[model samples]
Target: MRLTRPMLALTGAVAVLALSACGAGGDDEAKAPETATGSLEQLAAKAKCDPNMQTDADEIRQAICTTGKDKYILATFATDRGQAEWLSGAKDYGGYYLVGRKWVAVGQEKTVTALQGKLGGTMEEGSEHMNPGGSHNKGGHHS
Candidate 1:
């Protein structure tokens, strides 16, 4: 075909847009499949826990203070059956964990640790954006 400057530019732009669109939003389910994190969001939303619950941080499903050892264990299943744990204990500070059913709670520590052990994952630490998978860390730093 004949070479045209405008045609080439437009073609390039279109290709870029298409490529960007592919990576636009949400992770791929088929390729990576649904991880435990995906299930947490689903269950929390269903329970009407809070809209703000879904975040890159370990804060509550919302900003509510999860005082007194209370925590939430969001367990997602491949069969669309989501589970939740409104765990409470003895601290005014609580955390949320995006975990799976396979996770087990030892003596102490959030189920995230137990689940992480089962999944061969390190209970994420620090900001969600800092990790490779964008998960919340154990310390639960909302900032």
Candidate 2:
């Protein structure tokens, strides 16, 4: 087999295209949107969290919010692993929760849980900085 430069370049291009088509290498079910329909701002409103939008180096959209005393962060990642990595790092600081692939919340457990309910996702507990996971019917009213 003659491995010419042109052939190598062609191969590389094809490989790149194939990888791009795969789209983050995850199940479609896992990547479902956390909300029914709305912008991040709308979701924040529904969740009763102030939206301080920011993106991390990985391009994850972080929406930080606070209810005077309590604060939290929400973001969406492309893959479960990405979300896990974010949660792992974020758990150290304080309350962090994953609301599917489309949302993450970090702050007081009650606040995060409230957001989780509003956003429609699961709560990932087991961090020292976070209290036990459960939806709080009180507090977390965002102004």
Candidate 3:
């Protein structure tokens, strides 16, 4: 079989188109939202909670939300770097974190997990910092 240059180009184009079509099919579900895309209140609404505004600043906005009996902190950052920095510092406290782009929800493991159902995010577990010294007994040393 003899293949001409034009025939080769056409074949390459067809292959590219086929691959693109395959990728497009499940893109909606396959790709997570690039960003949470809402204010603290809006996000809280999505999780079925009315946020009690805790901190409203230019760089970040935070609020306390209670869905059912579970209470969680919902925070959104103006910049990705700010969110990452905040997460890094907060993780030292050791708790459950639901992280989405430019936003995070912090609370108990169950609470965070439940929030994940309504808000799409990845779960992160913070490491607990241990006390260096033994427990200080306020009762004083026994004789």
Candidate with best TM-score: 3
List clashing residue pairs in candidate 2: 72-106
Instruction: Return the top candidate by lDDT.
Output: 3
Worst 10 residues of 1 by lDDT: 83-92
Candidate 1 per-residue lDDT over residues 1-143, each given as its tens digit: 34233432233233222222121122222232233333444444433333223222222221211212323333222332211222211111222233344321111233333333323322323223323223444456555
Could you report the Cα RMSD, in angstroms, for every candidate shown?
18.8, 16.8, 22.1
Tens digit of lDDT per residue, candidate 2, span 30-56? Answer: 333355334456666766667776544
Each prediction's whole-model lDDT (CA): 0.29, 0.48, 0.61
TM-score for candidate 1? 0.19
Error of 1 at 120 (Å): 2.8
In model 1, the runs with Cα more than 4 Å from the true position are: 1-72, 77-93, 96-110, 125-143
For model 3, how does the per-residue alpha-carbon lDDT over 38-129 read when each residue is reduced to its tens digit? 77877888878878886676777777676656666788888898788777666654566789988888766656666676787998866433
Model 2, position 24, has a per-residue lDDT of 20
Q: What is the lDDT of residue 17 in candidate 3?
A: 28
- Cα-based lDDT at residue 110, candidate 3: 58
